[model samples]
Target: MHEDIHVGGGLVTAFVAYALAAFVILIILRFAFARLRFSRYVANAPLAEAGLYVCVLALLIAFI
Candidate 1:
């Protein structure tokens, strides 16, 4: 007979950790972009931010 293993809080913990990491990364990127006057060059700042967030999330998932 095979024993079933239970992972208590493991999934939730990993999710929260990834979310926190992404938030921190986005904040750092925001400051860097602000310092470089990056918004001035972008036609749609909100859209760009969303795209950046998705890209960053994908990268985190791919590499992590």
Candidate 2:
């Protein structure tokens, strides 16, 4: 008999953790840029932040 199981649990969890960390780092970068008045040079910062948030949510879902 054969059983179906997933062996990538650790990988999935790691992906989730990495995504969360990336999200946090990106947020911090965005905040620092805004505070330093460099946001104008990087207008896509908000978009990148939003994309990272979405990626984090997706990774969490994937891990589950």
Best by lDDT: 1
The list of candidate 1 runs beyond 4 A from truth reads 1-13
Q: Write the per-residue lDDT of candidate 1 for residues 1-64, one digit (tens) a residue.
A: 1233346843344545555678789889999999999899999998898888878877776777
Error of 2 at 17 (Å): 0.3
Model 2: lDDT to the true structure: 0.62
Count of clashing residue pairs in every prediction: 0, 0
lDDT of 2 by residue, 1-64 (tens): 1233345663244554556666786778667767887646666767766776787667555655
Model 1 lDDT, residue 55, Cα: 82
User: How much lDDT does each candidate structure score?
Assistant: 0.75, 0.62
Candidate 2 wrongly placed segments (more than 4 Å) = 1-12, 48-64
Predicted model with the maximum TM-score: 1
Lowest summed lDDT window (length 10), candidate 1: 1-10
TM for every model, in the order presented, reads: 0.72, 0.44
